[model samples]
Target: MHTAITSQPLPSAAEAALARESSRVLSACLQTRSDAQQIELHDEQGATHPVRVPVSALRLLLDVLTEIGAGNAVSIIPIHAELTTQEAADALNVSRPHLVRLLEQGDIPFHKVGTHRRVRYQDLMAYKQRIDAQRHEALDALAEEAQRLGLGYD
Candidate 1:
């Protein structure tokens, strides 16, 4: 199923604390060598239920919990999903106009449906990775230049 891109609010302090504790417990459980793991869930009425989940799914849950524990908002988008221009912009943390410019410049590819532009999640991620790598390379170069110049940036 394709999930629409949406912004999620950061976890509240109480929720963050609970997530931190839950992540810690789940981390311990994930250290087992089993392919699947059984975990217990406790309801408000003090009823306990056990559920068996694939280790991969458990690892994903742990990642979500870890982000929430750090008070960060998290959104899951399937790799095959198509996003609207605005959604793609939001994913890149850029303005829609800027993203449109990138699309027009051919820095990223997009397809149109009924006059609306749609970007593939995978393409957007590829573009992001490319730009991020370039940025890191530029930064590393600047740092090297600074060290060579004896600018005291040791």
Candidate 2:
């Protein structure tokens, strides 16, 4: 999968300031629907133009800008992009061999591309979400059991 990320150098001071303001504007704009979701862009020539962007895209842009403002590295990978087994394993924070076993057990779906397996980014995300939810549920159940046994306090 192709990931879009900022280069090594983080955003400049001015860019960080702009990112803060843009984050506010994008957050506010996403909460309400206007006739057009537009933002002004200023070019090096000092010319300003309005550009329309989808609300979903604006949300992502806002998140990226916020992360950059906080001096964090950000990467955007398309949900539909295909990833190699190693890449998928990295995404899941699992070993490549373990990931392959999961694939063999039909835990995650995949497709073969000329003898090489490829997993969609969306599928990986889905599996991660499911696992996270299951973990949360199990934790909650354990907490409840502890409370019932007087091991947990209010």
Screening candidate 1 with a backbone cut-off below 3 angstroms (N, C-alpha, C), the clashing residue pairs are none
Q: How many clashing residue pairs appear in each of the predictions shown?
A: 0, 0
Question: What TM-score quantifies how close candidate 1 is to the native fold?
Answer: 0.90
Which regions of candidate 1 fall more than 4 Å away from where they truly are?
A: 42-48
* lDDT for each residue of candidate 2 in 4-83, tens digit (9 for 90 to 100): 32235777888888888878877877886654587799999999999988777877888899987786666777878888
Best candidate, lDDT: 1
Per residue, candidate 1 scores C-alpha lDDT tens digits across 1-154 of 2458877988999999999999999998899788899878999999999999999999999999999999999998889999999999999999999999999999999998889899999999999999999999999999999999999998
Listed per candidate, the RMSD to the true structure in angstroms reads 1.8, 3.1
TM-score of each candidate?
A: 0.90, 0.79
- lDDT for model 1, on a 0 to 1 scale? 0.93
The ten-residue window of minimal lDDT in model 1 covers 1-10
